[model samples]
Target: MTRKKNSGDFLKECMADALFILLRTKSIEEITVSEITALANVSRITYYRNFTSKEKVIEFKLDKLISQWIHEHPRKESASAYESSLSFFQFFYSIHDIVQTLIRANLSVMLLNRLILKFHDFNTPDRNEYYRQIFISFGLCGIILTWMDNGMKESPEQMAETVSRRFFPQPEP
Candidate 1:
């Protein structure tokens, strides 16, 4: 049973990888299941078994990537906006190629929506604080999307500093 599950997981990963590779040169709508299956060296039945559509495959990949990112970063509620933004930009920059492809395809909203959902903190005790987290999630998503749109010219440190200054202004002396 474990072996079967592992094989299924492997096939799903292969299909997801193939779709992203094709996405670099072709829009998501332009690439069909046949193309993905061909590139992945898998059968149509395999593709159908694993994913409902190309969009589903992309969502699966994004979810996996976000899960990995969360595990690695483990967001701290105590971290300042600058620290959080720095890590966010650094991580996204590392995967900028995949991001750029998604942007070019006009599917950037997928990233934004996924990030908003993933960044939410479920354990918040106060309803107001929960809403605050939601707002922060949207704000963070906006900042990253804008950075990607502008070709991410600034270094992560530069971007983080700019965001920190704008969002959390210091009082005058």
Candidate 2:
């Protein structure tokens, strides 16, 4: 027999969908927990149990998307930072709607900061690896935030190439 579905995940998805639906009609500041729970058909207690705040609902979704993308499109072990970064931007661009909403809610920076923590590899003995992750997160996040803010006129490939050149330039021989 198949295992039962995890009701917790289902509730979270309901809440997330409710939140996103509200966001389309109202800014994050205008939304309240009451509205989310009411729309999601879940109690306020369930919301609090799964998410600390409304912002968390969005962060949870974004974190999952990013992790899934990274996992599915594994970077080559020998790939340079530029290649890795381009791959990331490509995937991020594919989900521009979510990122756009996060920016509109003014929670993009906070999400990125928290996600940097989530993705940190504590098992590594190398301190530089930790620092490298932080550096990459901030740098890449800065570029993407700017692009999103400035109307995102450039195509994903263009944005990736431009950012890669500025931030992850080729090393001189």
Highest TM-score model number: 1
Count of backbone collisions in candidate 1: 0
RMSD of each: 2.3, 2.9
lDDT of 1 at 140: 78
lDDT, model 1, position 16: 91
Best by lDDT: 1
TM-score of every candidate: 0.87, 0.79
Weakest lDDT window of 10 consecutive positions for candidate 2? 1-10
Candidate 1 regions exceeding 4 Å error are 122-127, 170-173
Off by over 4 Å in 2: 1-5, 122-132
What TM-score would candidate 2 get against the native?
0.79
Q: Write the per-residue lDDT of candidate 2 for residues 75-114, one digit (tens) a residue.
A: 6879876677678777767877777777877767866775
